[model samples]
Structures are given as structure tokens and as C-alpha cells.
Target: MKRGIVFIATLMMLGSCGIFLPRPEFEKGMTERRFLRQNRDAKISNLDNGKTTYRVDRGERFFVLATFEDGKLVKLEERESRPNWMTPQEDPEKRNR
Candidate 1:
């Protein structure tokens, strides 16, 4: 009975630790080449000043954007669409001007 209790306690502790652990997903400073290799179908756009942008369509209603500078990923963004009744049609203010 004591061994079973200890085993259950260890399992519970390990399981809970996963919630606090940092998983490698959508973090900046990742290698752009590796990212492109992983996401082969992603659309890539070349920009000026050694900047490159990648866009991946998650589904019909959402997409992800990542930007790289000097071959290293530097920015990440995500967009999701709302229902037509709640949609907004306006461009956001541009940054990095």
C-alpha cells in the first residue's frame, strides 16, 4: 500500500510539472531555415534589409505570421477571423516606421 501511494504521488507531481514547463512553440530567435524546413507549405515573402516573413494558414479562419532578420526569427504574430457579422474591415496602424 505504501509503494502504491508513493507511485501515485510521483505520477501526480510529474504530471503537474508539465503545466509549468515551457514548451518550444512559437518562440522568437529560432532559426529561420529550420522553421521553413519544418513548415514547408508556409508562404514566404522577402523583404528589404535582410528581413523575411513567413505566413502559415492554420485553417480557414486563422493564420500565423513570423518574421526573421539576418536568418533568425525575430517576431511572431497570429490572426484569427471572426464571424461575418462581427468582422471588422480596417487596416491596423503600421509599426517600425
Candidate 2:
């Protein structure tokens, strides 16, 4: 019985892993304005090539880079592999060091 319980618990833990997996947003064809509204506090850098890079502060020591062109989101790259479930309302300095 104990072994059965342990096995079930392990299976449950493994099954829930997908819930924490991060999904990439900011795919091609998304509007820049909409992205900006979603990431309201993101730090933005405008490039000379008419592309803008938005540095998003993801909580728990993570961040993401989103690039836009012609007011449309063109690219999204994460600085590290992590979950995208972090809340934007989190304090940047405290969680992302």
C-alpha cells in the first residue's frame, strides 16, 4: 500500500509538470501596441533599423526579449528557459536580480 501511494504521488508530480511549462508568446503578426499593453512596465529600446526591443522583467530571476517592427511583434526570445506564468505586477528589482 505504501509503495502504491508513493508511485501515485510520483506520477501526479510528473503529470503536473506541464502546468508549469512556459509557452512562448509574442509570435509573429502580434501587434506591438497590444504587447506593450500587456507588458506595461517593460523597458523598451528603440533600434535604428526600425525594430524595437522590449526587455520584459519576468519574476524569479528571469526575463524575456521581444522585438517589434512596424508596430507588429516579430520576435520573442527568452533570456533563460523558464515558465511564462510569472505575474507582471511583481516587483522587478526584488524578484529579478
Error of 1 at 19 (Å): 16
TM-score of 2: 0.52
Tens-digit lDDT string for candidate 1 (1-97): 9999999999999999999986575667889878887788789855767888888888888888899998888989898956687876565554333
Whole-structure CA lDDT of model 2? 0.80
> Candidate 1 regions off by >4 Å?
1-23, 81-97
TM-scores of the models, in the given order? 0.57, 0.52
On TM-score, the candidate that comes out on top is 1
Per-residue CA lDDT of candidate 2, range 1-97, in tens? 9999999999999999989986555668788887877778888855758988989888766788888888888788888645567545767888878
Q: Which stretches of candidate 2 lie over 4 Å from their true place?
A: 1-25, 81-97
lDDT of 1 at 7: 100
